[model samples]
Target: MAAFTASVIPIVSFILITLAVRCHATALIEGLYCGKKNCYDVLGINRDSDKQDIAKSYRRLARKYHPDVSKESDPEEKFREVANAYEILKDDESRRDYDYMLDHPEEFYGHYYRYYRRRMSPQVDVRVVIAGVITFVSIFQYMHGWWRYNDAMKYLLNEPKYRTMAVSKANELGLLSKIERRKRPKEDVKADEEAVLRKMLEENVDVRGGYSRPSLWDVMWVRVVLLPYTLVLYVIWWFKWQWTYFVMKQEYTEEDRHYLTRKALKLTTVQWESIGREKQSELIEKELWVNDNFQAYTNQQQEEMKAKYAESAKYRRYRRYMKNHKPGPIVDSD
Candidate 1:
């Protein structure tokens, strides 16, 4: 009875394995470009044929069926069939998949996956694509930065405040002579004036934050190229931070204090700069660089905001509405 049971188990396992193989093969055959015809039969090659043998056979078949060269009645269709067979068998990976499909002709999904994967796979090298993308992004970023800088310059040129200052500076430098202005065409005179204003802005004005001059280092390609150096610097900074804050427990430096103050105010460098130098000086004068002072300042501001909100009619109306209305699901009626 024990022997019989063991024999029966082996037979059951064999039958299950055979069924799985058949299912896999069926799936692959369904996805073949040549329909139900075997690729090996199409290529006139045996199942055990090597790459060289397959290539040789393909060459002969291709030449015989080629529409341009062959005298065959259905040369186009015959050439296509030959090309399709060669395409499947040319690559080692694809050939292996084809061989698997032939061996296990029952798996429907596996064949579809194999077909789609081959069809969808990129022909270009991934690294080349990545490099092209980085280059494009860097160029775009650099161009965009310059565009914004130009817009800011245009604004400054148009504004009376800055325009008057620039005109004065140009006059002091003797760039806008009355004689030259009179002799030249009005268009030329206007151009010269614009040039002078641009020069004055470039020399005197210190543009900061987003409107600041674009640098190669800010572009994606440059950043990617310098990533290793940046990583090294980051590691050193981490070590220094650990030593300063944990090991030494030292007080913050002037730069550190400024950074912390900016963080406390929840301001980006651009936003902080937009506050103007006078406002910045006022904040610094209040000793906000000190952690305790910063905390107290924040608390005071929060309390002031709360008092203002309580007094506001808009806030009162919003609060009253929310309190009076209880959220509930909407009922549908026919």
Candidate 2:
């Protein structure tokens, strides 16, 4: 008798729990979809309806409820409901989920899972979207780079110093001609002159830094495509670096020495190039290629900077202000 009572208690608890879960799932379904109406009912179809029947019903209902065709007060809202119902019922997986929800309303978690999964799923392929985005970004980057380069060229062409040099070079190359200028239209002549200037700038002017011309290889898509190759090269470089510095203790080549010197000066390739050839030659003459010499050079530069700053007008003004404002006892003039 005692054993039977214990078993009966568990069975009663199970039944109560099942009833509660079913009640919750039904409430959730009621809230999720078109109020108390089922998706099939929204599409005017039965549970046993086939895809063809479902599609047919959806098309009919959709057209009937369409805002343009219907004279109903809220055709737009009705159209949305019809479309939503059709969207769920049109897919086999979604339809199966809906059927399962109807059959086993006690499975509240499963119902929620299926509903969200369908809702959150993307309509387009993720890979295609990613590729499209990369392509667009690459194109924008390439165009922007060219725009900057052109702006730099235009600035150089307008500069008196660079223009003089460009004009001289263009004349030497037979690009600028008085006869051609006289014969051509004003617009044509101006275009020809600008073209000549640009050509000369391209050949003579070392347009470096951020204003350098764009390259296809520098684009985002190209960079992404070459990522694997870049990784391979990096690995090889790492091994080579380890071998050179640790195992072989190889002597630095001229290029390597120059690179080290630039590194010591904390200068990028663009910055080093902008410092001018004469200045570079002077730095090289100081034997900055050697670590000890580079350190000494750095110290000398710091001292020079300190001296220059001390001689500056701002520093002099600051010193004068500090001298006048020195902390001392205030004298009573009154």
Candidate 3:
């Protein structure tokens, strides 16, 4: 048991240290909802204290430890403690939480608040401690990049993962996370897509050099600016290649060309698949347009023949010419 406890001591120590800082875990359950006035009221000020009265009381106590006035060894520390309590009582939300805790005394008992205190208390299938810790740790990774820089050596130097552990203890105490972003459902995504499509149809996408990250023109102008930079860089690169090329000059073979080609076409799988689908859509549209155009041409020819046999002026001229030339009297009026 001693060995087990000994092995667990570091973890416990870290957890207690974590809980002490995060409000939900470190603070007394009563601290949040307590209506009890603090040390400041009992010792520092009277119950009927007004703002001026409170300020006067603080000034008196402050002077006692004023560091300039009081030479008492711990007088400065007492002054600070009184000052902190006074600040909290003055704030509105802090005062509300204080009043709330006072009103609800039975809620924070051993597991009542953690196991059943939340608005989401009904779906209590999983132990909140474990679930809350996991959620906190996952979110912590995304924030601050605080723990990402940690290495094995850093851990050896006596570091607790600050962001992750703080988040976990805070969650354990019922503090909601700040980092979770709300997401839309599938239906909402479709609605958003339609809205964007409507906006696109109304406006031109071509306004900003047309959606290609850099259009060909953009690339060309960038190249124009980069030309001098490119030359300067090339001179540096040439010296490097000249030095290295001589070393490998005898061993260089055509095989290096294949590796160079492979590097240029690198792209994520999603991008390649998206390009394929867009090309397929274009091919389908082209086929349908060609078919529609051919059918339209046939209809137009039939309409021209019908008009020639009827009474339009241009058709009338054709009919007159036909009759004069003895092909047959072309019909006139419909």
Candidates, ranked, lDDT: 2, 1, 3
lDDT of 1 at 217: 78
Which scores higher on TM-score, 1 or 2?
Answer: 1
Off by over 4 Å in 1: 1-28, 33-36, 45-56, 67-77, 102-108, 121-132, 177-183, 273-295, 303-334
lDDT of 2 by residue, 1-334 (tens): 9999998999999999999776745743665555566787788889889889989998898888899889888999889989988888888888788778777777878788878877789978899999999989998999999999999999999999999999999888777875275566899888889888888899888888889988898899989999999999999988987899779998766666667668778899989878888887687667786789988987999999999989899999998998999878889999
Report, for every candidate in turn, its global Cα lDDT versus the true structure. 0.83, 0.84, 0.50
Error of 1 at 214 (Å): 2.5
What lDDT score is found at residue 96 in candidate 2? Answer: 80
Over 4 Å off in model 2, which ranges? Answer: 1-28, 34-53, 56-83, 92-136, 182-187, 260-265, 276-299, 311-318, 325-334
Could you tell me which 10 consecutive residues in candidate 1 have the lowest summed lDDT?
24-33
Model 2, position 223: C-alpha lDDT score? 95
Q: How many residue pairs of model 3 clash at the backbone?
A: 7
**Best to worst by TM-score, what's the order?**
1, 2, 3
Which portions of model 3 miss their true places by more than 4 Å?
A: 1-37, 46-50, 71-73, 109-334
Considering every candidate listed, which one attains the maximal lDDT?
2
Residue-pair clashes, model 1: 13
Candidate 3: C-alpha lDDT: 0.50
